[model samples]
Target: MPRVSFAPPSLCLTFLPLLERLLPSLPPTVRDVDVPPLFREQFILSGYRPVDLSWRCYVLSLFQIHNETLSVWSHLLAAVYVLVRFLMFAVQQGGGILGVGLQGPEGQGFSVDVSSLPLVLYVFSAVTYLSCSAAVHLLHSEQTHHSLFFLEHVGVAVYQYGCALALCLYSSDTGWTQSMLGQIFLPVVAVVVWLSCIICCYADLHFHRPYLWHRRICQVVPMGVAYLLVISPVTHRLASHNWTNTSTLPLHFLQVALFLLSAVFFSCPVPECFSPGRYDIIGHSRQLFHILLSICTLVQQEALFEDFLWRRQALVREFGEERLLLACASFLGLTLCCVMTALVMKRRTHVQLLQEGR
Candidate 1:
């Protein structure tokens, strides 16, 4: 056998350039003026990845420095972290694949409960929305931007339904639950959430750059309605309950505050608007929105988990098995409706793009 020659570290470093040359390179990022108006974020003056690149290029672009890089990684990491934390919590609680168990009153042994179902659904929705948001950032292309936008809206609708479901079941006080509005809250929320998704998609399709305010109003109004409906229970609980008695109340307040602050960033470009080109690579309003929303989700999850554990028995007794099942089923149906709505909107978007091309 011929003597084998081992390259020293310095000599190995010399081949790094050649190795890099053999691999595919990321597409060059473009300035706002270089891309179509549809892809240009307001006040984000640079670091846009070129449009019409291959899917592989878009995926590879995740590692490259660009405006959407943080948006993609923030939610992607959040989804993974949320999922892992949930699974760890489930395992620690001695839960099965479907639900978690807690020790019963009077020294009764731990038992698997359907009361955990809403919480489970909430976690599922959180993961889904985070993943969808990440995909909207990562896989965005000129051809499919409308579809991704619709998908993100659907994800938001699903998440809103999840929060409403959990709050309705676990967080609402008995007085609130028995109230007229609470009786019909979930049903109304389902309608409003679906409408919100539709309105957002329609706004995206109909309004271009010049009609920015019109589009924002269309998108924000339905969402505001849905949010108010969903948050009503939390508001009631906060108002009625004794402040010093509950540990989770602070988390509820924190989540609400964080979400409201995030909405500001979502609606307006801040530091970027003031110093356009400087924030292109980082610290933009959208990135801040993503970060704040992720934290809000975590805070909300923690508060809900506490409520679920403390009130699980009361909730089960009050709502009964049939009502709980119905509530979960309604949410599932809402999710299906939102998805169908997105698909329809996506098809319309594709047709419009084709017509525009023609």
Candidate 2:
């Protein structure tokens, strides 16, 4: 037998500090005053990561204490969970690009055909936005912040379109679907969503810290219009729904409430506003917004899934397969337009950065 040798305690102690030094350490964070103005958060005075860190350091910062840590992990984990759930659902239905059917209330079977395209698109959009948000939060540095911010705006535009597409196809009441608004809703929504992205990017580019009010207005107005337009179907559905049938009603209500509350937190910094630096590492408004929005998304998904199962046959027969494919194709076109807009804005941002000697 070979004798096993263990290092003595003294020898181990001597190497401990050296080993620690050899390993990558968490980068030191700075105060709001120390970093560039673009990196500072309103009412957040400390725990700001330095602007000029290597890509590896920023990736490592995910596990370290910083203002964006919670923001990053919150949406990152939500995206992963949603993706895993979708995969599991697909496996259960049938291991294919298109599943046969899903078991619904009381074990009723509903067909999954091209009619399922909207649901798939909505899930893809949700994952895209959530992943994009996480990436923006994780990799945001002075060098990449502008391009990433524009990317985030594009994600929002895509998500809005996704929600509109699903609600229009699946959740709208029969009466509403036949109404005038429904006839022209999707085309108008596509344009509005693109405009919202452009407005958001423009606001960020032109407005600095002092023009916060103008920036907020420019950002909020277009988004509010797009949101109202996209959510009209759901609003109409909820209002016209029979209260006696309480199956998916509660989920709709919960999703709406969560979304509204999240908007409040997103627009206004709370607990942190009251006491600066107190919530820098925890319990900030943005963190709350991310959590609430994620929950809202999950609830919305469940409600939509239930609605899809209940109305699949009617939807397919009424709209026909051609219309369904057309709607999806139109949405794809809108996605391309939004991506182009982001790229153009990103190029403009790079030019501006160079001009400013950044």
Candidate 3:
């Protein structure tokens, strides 16, 4: 006779095969807590920090898990939408020019290039904000927290200035460009002031860990001033009992309100802040901010579309091509300046992070 002993399968060995299968599906090197101090204030509980990830992994993150997934996807998709809009406007402008040229007295060449400046800037600004935001959220860990944050703000300034210019171009007659004293100058001043505000914040650069709301208000206030200056014509017309462009007025005001609410969400950062770990992967305020911002931009894009149809000829007749081109060049220069400052800040901060052993 022999004594026989039977043992159950080892739990570790039994699960090993399944674990191996799931391992490839999971993101490698996902950090759960213990995020470095530099990234703390920027992310505010981004669940798993992916450290030292390659650019390939950053792109793969389009499908991977992380706190920034929503923020990244929303803006990237917006970038696609904007590019499509840019093309759509170009095609329509071509059609309009062709139709007008054939019907007009001369039936010769047209100045579609100058007429399309607003839309071009509209596209440029949209792409800037969307791509920069997507880049920031997707690669914040790569650039260190503060550097990306600074870049994101600068991107918004450029985008805001673009939106302001677009609305002014389509909102008013081209004559506005000639009257630098009363009208066009306001927006340029506002852009300068907005840049100054951004620079001041980065001067000593507190980054405002606890007082996130203060930073939010500080950044948006100057932007709001720029917006207000650009839209003053609308305000003036409506106040003076002129109902010419009333159709877009209500929608524009609605957009202004939505943006104001976006600021509120940015400042408060609710739900996520309420339960730190609970909303780590989703439902964060930044996600909401990005969504609201996209919607606001979309609404404004539509408004510009209608305004363009109405104001196209007025724009062509009122402002010369040289003036429009110079203005576009100036806008591009200002946008470049903001971007340059952000680049410099990023490099300096990278050095700081290295010294701090992050």
Candidate 4:
């Protein structure tokens, strides 16, 4: 056999670079330490991680290797799905994607009602929440994350109000907001409830170290209470509502249960905590929370749509969809104002750390 001589190292180096260019490439993966402190959870070992690289690199990182890849995609895709569905619904009625002023009972031969506009805003709020979640986890900017958390909780609170209004619309013989006063206490109580949630969520970020455990507990308490309070009233009257049968409660309960489960996963990072880095990539508590929350949103959406379709006759007979839309517009405005107000700015510790090049 003829002896084979290896190429010179320098010559080999030249060919290696060219060969690398010719071959299929993969985005680089990262270690946890290179990621944000928020992601430095216990046991998070070998998943894809985000680094504070350049802006272009950060955008490219979406498809690149990272632990939060699934989280970013799931929520982003969910927002897309909601937007698409809303657009489809709006297209048929000749309304814009926002679907403003386009309302009727759900079903074929869609009729128009001006009063039903507020439901459109509520849908917008839900979409806002999902979209913000995707943005926050994907970008992971300290300022944006903190601000987005405020936005996220506010979105959640607004969606809950929408949920209450939908349920109230179903339960009563009047339009959505008109009947909101006596039966649906959520609209009245929600201002306090959501504002409290926003504050706690803000504190969770703004106040770091010292009583870290205490801060976490404080976050959980508000969320836990909000979940309990919001779900109970919205779901309790589902079956007995004028538009729904006794049998519907089971399905409605499923929606509420999913929301509750999502809350549990959100508040208690159980299995992930137990296993640590084992579930850093997928099946993490946060990912689970995202999935459950999306499912709950869909479940409630379908039910409310159906409830509106059947219940529209009653509402149209009384106040009309236009009136309902107009009245709830104020409520939507209040929610937006409160959320914007709660989005308080604070000095970002993580950004400061990164600035020192640590």
Candidate 5:
């Protein structure tokens, strides 16, 4: 034997084979995930880093005080205000409609036999407000991308549904077919078209591009044409019948056009592609568009009510009472359900995490 020396293998050499195996088995990094090229371009334009600490938690921590804090609180306060208003309106309307000694719209004491239309409408308004508030507050603490994305999409639908419900209630309260063109019957056809567009757009998003081309060709494009055509005849009838004064026609047309334009803008985001971060926090095209739309809807509410009152007075009286009670109960129930589900999910997650720690 030369020197009879024995030496252990080096640690690095001993683990080299295992390390090579792991290199081959590991998945790609997060940056390597397949995202759209447009999105990639947006990221580059944003000048945002993948590893930078997000302001999300800081923003959420300000549930106590900050700009967004007040914004959140403002929406919540608005929702509460709406809820209170609904309660008051329901009490007043329900009492009258149920044949109790309740004051009617004219302050005359009469036996109210109308179904719950007034109450239902109020509840609908309250629910809409609540949904908005919930959406706003939730924007901060989303933690995960999916939650925010889904919630935003859902917010649009909720807002749309609220608007539609409010309009339908106005129609029911006054009269659907009693207006100038409403009476002529094409309004129904127009409404059907408009509603079909809404359904198609919502379905496309919710179902992930169902009947994509068909929706564009059949529902969306047709809806646009139908909307324009229906509006002309209806406006003409309204003006001639004195439902709306002739002098108001120009103003009304402008208002209607504004809403239609807003909808189009919202459906298609423009000018954001050039400068993405410029609109990241505020002044986004869609936000401005929605604000304008909400205003337009509020303005049109009166005209809609006038038209409906003339046409659907009997239907209003019929469902005015029962619908209210049912809706109030439904609102309370829904609120409770949302709260409970959120709480239960939170608790379960916490419990699971704690057990894992143990």
Candidate 6:
């Protein structure tokens, strides 16, 4: 026989068998996988080890099939859906932020300056969708346990930030005057308290940081309760019988509650999380969150639209032009936030990965 070329024991004896056993299929279960020699050699030469990269890649691999594929596409499609709706609204009612409204006869639909309000509202809603979409895609791809745990919350933060901005704009536009009760609670204080509650909830989930024995009092329950306490009073005032044309409390309260509920749904992760791998590719917590979020966004748009109509018909009808323009601005901001956040995160992750690769 021809002389056999000597192979290194590490390569011949160690890695060959492992390679034969692993990596044949795209979505092979890898919780207990052995490192192949080629990859191991790369690691040794680079003086680094796999830092959950494989798992991250593996989890993201679900995009090809498994459970999370539908989840990913669901939000991706939802983003597209929102974009279409926003565009339709813009086309039907032309004018930029601060535009004139439709003032024509009943049949004509000729308008005054009710333009900007729609656009601005659209923008805020778009931001919410984009942030949510990015979070889903990124987390799905995140294989390492730590990556999943850390990046997951970022999505919620994005969602909350968008809502906060929207609420702030509403507060200013409608001149949500502070009452004595509100003075005692304060907007700034409310925000701080909500943020604190959110942070505490996240800590409980990831860090297993302990809390009071009353389980119901922990996590989302506390958040919901705190929300009611801080926001309810103002919402109640807005909805109170004494109010007439301008108060935006009832609609605002409804929108805010729905938004909060969406977040809670995301955090609690019912149905799928309970089933685990059964919903890995579809019907997962993230997917449900996306659906609820979309509905919430649509509801919010309607609420904002109603507010705009009220403002034009009754409150400060003088600036129909300005209101329209403001709406457009808001729309642009919301739509852009989604695309912008995705690009930013992509760039950041790419840079970090490249640096790590080096």
- Best-matching candidate per lDDT: 1
Tell me how far the alpha carbon of residue 128 in candidate 5 is from the true structure, in angstroms, after superposition. Answer: 1.9
> How well does each candidate superpose onto the true structure, as a TM-score?
0.90, 0.89, 0.76, 0.74, 0.44, 0.50
Give each model's whole-structure lDDT: 0.87, 0.86, 0.67, 0.63, 0.43, 0.47
| Candidate rank order under TM-score | 1, 2, 3, 4, 6, 5
| lDDT of predicted model 1 | 0.87
Report the lDDT tens digits of candidate 5 across residue range 209-280.
222354345434644554454355444444455534543334455558777877675555455656755653
Q: Write the per-residue lDDT of candidate 6 for residues 101-177, one digit (tens) a residue.
A: 44545645654444344335445446554645545454433233223333433343334434443343333333343
TM-score of 4: 0.74
After superposition, the stretches of candidate 6 with alpha carbons farther than 4 Å from their true spots are 1-63, 98-125, 137-155, 164-234, 237-269, 272-286, 312-358
Better of 2 and 4 by lDDT: 2
Candidate 6 or 4, higher TM-score: 4
How many steric overlaps does candidate 6 have?
45
Candidates 1 and 6 compared by TM-score, better number: 1
Sequence-dependent TM-score of model 1: 0.90
What is the Cα-based lDDT of residue 308 in candidate 2?
Answer: 76
Ranking by lDDT: 1, 2, 3, 4, 6, 5
Best by TM-score: 1
Model 2, span 244-311: residue lDDT tens: 68567778778878988998888899979999999998999998989898888888888877877787
Error of 1 at 137 (Å): 0.8
Better of 4 and 5 by lDDT: 4
